[model samples]
Target chain A: MAAHMTNAHRRFLQVLMSNRITEGSEARKLHQHCCETDKVYYAHDKLDDFISTINSHLQPLFMQIRKGISEDDGRAHYAVVNLAETEVTKMASDYTEMELELFRKTMDLIILSENGFASSTDILNLADQLKTKKMKKKEAEQVLKVFVEDKWLSEKNGEYTLHTRCIIEMEQYILSYYQDLAKKCNLCHSLAIQSQVCESCGIGMHLPCARKYFRGQTEPRCPKCNEFWSCDTPGVNRMGSQT
Target chain B: GKEKANELHSEMSAFDSTAFAEDLLTFMGINRTEVEETNDSEDVPADFLPSHAWQKMGEEALKYFRRAPTFHYMMGSFKSESPVRKQRIE
Candidate 1:
């Protein structure tokens, strides 16, 4: 209990409670809005400090405001993470045991895949094999949509992968669960799921990181092995029009 | 007739409106505490609105929200359960 915990902090936390996760820019706007509404001191650069104040109060409650990056866009994000793992089903309480089982299996597919994504056809194939309770393909399809709407998974072109919110919230769990199999981005040094691997050394860098690092270079080289970067640098062609 | 009229007058005196109003307000859980609080403030006029009740309610609600697990932790917990139990078919 910091003496400075004010209504502004409470209001900001209340909004975050409903949202669960927020991108950096939206969070900054929220910070300003909360302070203005509560008539508290506001500083654009002090958002992190303000969050820390709220986090301190939440520490005893086994919660934290964690910062992570968007794997696809390389932008910052903040999410509320729960550190406690009691016997109770604390996450997604609204989901049934069968749905959770499907989710876990889906995670297996995505994390183990070389591309960090699992096609819907493959995930839907898991619907019948769920050991908790076999689900009809139709029911499983609806559940997948709910998971996407809840921000746990993102889908594109029939491919499904962990959403940015999931990465930010689950980075530690994934890192520990997969251990050596989970490679960190060579440039940013955070866990990189959707990343291009170095052919020579086997280190990984996020596509965005690779794009930024290799920008304006005549030839892209691996940051780790200094070998020729084999993978197509994502968004390389669009760089010309913007620059 | 005089004795009946006297009994009616006594019954009417017993049922004071001010006292009855106070009792009704107290049973509804209003007025008492706020009246006492506002009594000390001569400049500010007293009204019936509850003070700090919403702030207290918000704090109580937030207590539950703060304890909720993030999605990863929930999934991890589910994963740690007995594989034998989870393998049961419907």
Candidate 2:
């Protein structure tokens, strides 16, 4: 039988529902706060177990509290997922048909690109081409801003990539949909959107994972083929440098 | 024992459904008195009874709450193009 849900679990679920996603450190803090406030047993190392208890209750409702590591930084994150809905209907309630079309096109650009990013200009150009309803450049820009604010996408230097939460939730869907096109990181074995592709073998590894693997080596070599790893070693302080 | 059962029934009756319904209407930002007055004045259908209307509102609220998207669900929603988004223009 699953662990019984307590006031602490309910409190945590409430906060998570409102925030949608929380980073590892923040989740831990929230875990501690919930336990203390509810006068439940609190343990620093028991956050995962605490979440599992909540997940058991949510299973009947077709929801789950999922944990995943960020491809950009390798930091852990928690997001609530809906297991019942699929594809368009999942988001149709919040976004219009045109907006959904734009977002899908944006995903195509990012996922199919070598660097797993779509430039702002490229994404903006698709707005007018949307099949459902053409969106003006200004309208598309506003929608893009909303996407970022809602944490569906993250932007850097005017380039857009899927948010960590998106990757966590859609990993299986993306893998199945993209088939050979979407590559998984050989190291972590998870979907790698922002990754370095091996020139000879075509295997991919997330930048953070590659950094960790090649940290002390004199010359980085492909773990699979043992060939020279050609990509520039991402700097320690550059992206998700924290161990 | 018979007196105790009667006392329980009286206590239960003291909890007024109309008062509770008015409180719910106020919380939901609906003016129950205005609705009641309109129903009283107009040839409103039986379906427009205050209790029925509030019950409908409650069902709608439940639907909205249940459909509220989680962060993961919200992001996963944009994969409409599926295998690939077609090239719109050459």
Candidate 3:
């Protein structure tokens, strides 16, 4: 039995050293390719064969281990086997934890934005976008906390408002959300705060400001209206007065 | 409970020689001492239970130790090669 176990272990080590383990997308592609080339063999069969080859090598050892249980003393045998199994499980859990930590560190280095805020939503979106990406939820949360601390995006009054300087730097991002609200009357340089949006272009304006900018013309145009312009058109001067 | 105990005992008795050796050692209350004892008469040292128990216990311990590597392999616990590959995108 001992000799059989040694042979199994040695075979396993040989297979490992030879890099015979199937892994990743490449393995999947290979399986697909093999399946396509050989009608008799399916991709799943190849995978099963790979697993069984490794299993066969180890079966002898398992048999030997089971052989150590005596019928006369059932309780003691079960206890020993159970203890050994528990030890193995504990070792596996420790290894999984270490692997998870390493994955988190790698993601932290790669996914953080320049300003240091790792948005949880962004990370989740990124994971969704990248099928090959692997990250645990706990690790993602940790990365987000680090990003918030570094980027200074702490919440105040239940809102994630940036610090003053960051707000200035993030002007474009802030403006994007409020672009529809920016309107001015054609006549007045002051910001237009109210009125029906112009039919020609979608823009709300203060009624007086619109009349003043149009020079008392019957067809009053919105000063800051983007009717003829798409949002992306550059160099189009805004009509609204600077606040 | 009595029926369950009987069932368990019967199940245990069905175990092979390797299991018998282990059981004998446990019954004798000798922990790992039998593992190092050789087959020689001096090694048997009559003070212990009969020589057969010593022989059987030694054989069982050795078998169990030898099987350790195989058991580790079967579970993929000791196998370094993971079926899943780490992907690197350039």
Indicate which candidate wins on lDDT.
Answer: 2
Q: What is the lDDT for A36 in model 3?
A: 57
lDDT by residue (A39-73, candidate 1, tens digit) is 99999999999999999998987777888888888
Compose the digit string of candidate 2's lDDT tens values, residues B1-90: 987798688566687889998766665555333345446546644332454666767766876675553433554455444555244243
TM-score of each: 0.72, 0.72, 0.17
Which CAPRI level is candidate 3?
incorrect
In model 2, the runs with Cα more than 4 Å from the true position are A86-92, A236-243, B1-72, B75-90
Residue B77 of model 2 has an lDDT of: 52
Highest DockQ: give the candidate number. Answer: 2
DockQ winner between candidates 1 and 2: 2
Give iRMSD, candidate 2. Answer: 5.2
| All candidates in order of lDDT, best leading | 2, 1, 3
For model 2, residues A1-243, the per-residue Cα lDDT tens digits are 489999999889887876867899999999999999999999999998999999988998778888988887889998887766554446546787788888878888898899999999999999989888899999999999988987879999999999997787778767777666787899988888999989999899998899899877766889999998888766633333354
Per-residue lDDT over B1-90 for candidate 3, one digit per residue giving the tens place of the 0 to 100 score: 987798688565675998777666667655444534455566554345544666766766776663432111112222133344333334
Error of 2 at B75 (Å): 5.9
In order of the candidates, what TM-score does chain B achieve? Answer: 0.26, 0.26, 0.23
Q: What is the C-alpha lDDT of each candidate?
A: 0.79, 0.80, 0.36
TM-score of 2: 0.72
Off by over 4 Å in 1: A1-3, A88-92, A237-243, B1-90
Better of 1 and 3 by TM-score: 1
TM-scores of chain A across candidates: 0.93, 0.92, 0.21
Ordered by DockQ, highest first, the candidates read 2, 1, 3
DockQ for all models, in order?
0.05, 0.11, 0.02
